[model samples]
Target chain A: LAKTTQPISMDSYEGQEVNITCSHNNIATNDYITWYQQFPSQGPRFIIQGYKTKVTNEVASLFIPADRKSSTLSLPRVSLSDTAVYYCLVGNSMDTGRRALTFGSGTRLQVQP
Target chain B: EAGVAQSPRYKIIEKRQSVAFWCNPISGHATLYWYQQILGQGPKLLIQFQNNGVVDDSQLPKDRFSAERLKGVDSTLKIQPAKLEDSAVYLCASSPRTSGGTYEQYFGPGTRLTVT
Candidate 1:
């Protein structure tokens, strides 16, 4: 499993777009970038995933450059409810039918009203 | 569809005491995972089960933590002689097996254990 590094915390205002980047300099060729969100007293929930380039979902967008060494998670029009800890994990989690996610400290995104 | 279910949502135990948490994964899900999340930290994988069989348990502190997914549906995780540092949230997640690289997993509310 490749290691990932992200901001410890970020501050944002409501309706503002937030982009959190993660650095995985040692990412492998087959590794995929995944992001998960967790609110207080809840388990982490899958947010978005991408192998390369850009993958946009209803909730967020993931942008991975050609080098695959780094990725960014973009949240549009954030709200207070969007305040949560976001984790960036790099691994081929779904390979072999096992989704073994290796989580880091995660970036705590605080959306202020 | 019912999501993964975990109980008793919260537990308080003294050091050296034992506690158990139960979880029910979504129907037909073949893989179940146990994770330990300490306060302010991301969750760490404790164990993984693939249809009643253990797939990985490298991080499990086998001396005190033990989990089982008998029948490959509902599962239980037990902590024997809990310690202060053992206080954390135990999360249960499940995902269906697939050939492609789809990283989707459903998570339960989790069991918060406080070992005093």
Candidate 2:
């Protein structure tokens, strides 16, 4: 498993586009970048995932460059309900050996109305 | 499809006491995981079960904590001699074994344990 670094906090106005980047300098070839969103008193939910290039889903988009050292999660048209803590994790293996994820202080996205 | 289900949304217990949390995974999910989420931190994997068998429990405190997934459908996680540091939310997640890496695991509401 590779360690990841991301911003501690970000502020954005509703309807604005927000891009949160995470750096995993030690990422391995098999490592995949995954982003999760967590609201207060709730379990984290998967937002998006990507191994390289760009991947888009209904909720968010994940961009991984050729180097794969860093990945960015892009959220379009933010709303008040989008305010939550975002976590970036790097891991491989379908089960990843059940490796406990060490979550750093996540980037708190505050969507202002 | 039903998501992972957990019981006793909130629990308050004194240190050294015992508490138990239950979880029912999504139908046909062969892989179930238990995680501990402390305040301001991400959920940490405490144990993982493949069906009714234990897969990994390296992070679990075996002396104080035990979990079982009997019948491969539902599971129970129990903590004896709880400590104040044990206060955290217990989250349950389940995923199909054949889903591969691209598939996402479903999470439950979680059991918030407060050991005072």
Candidate 2 lDDT score at position A28:
73
Candidate 1 per-residue C-alpha lDDT over A8-100 given as tens digits, one digit per residue, 9 for 90 to 100: 999999999999999999987778888999999888898999999999999999999999999999999999999999999887745532234
What fraction of the true Cα-Cα contacts (under 8 Å, chains A to B) does candidate 2 also have? Answer: 0.52
Model 1 steric clash pairs: none
TM-score of chain A of each: 0.93, 0.93
Residue range B1-116, candidate 1, lDDT tens digits: 99999999999999999999999999999989999999988889899888999988888899999999989999999999799999999999998876555557789999999998
Model 2 complex DockQ against the native: 0.57
DockQ, each predicted model: 0.58, 0.57
* Interface RMSD score of candidate 1: 2.6
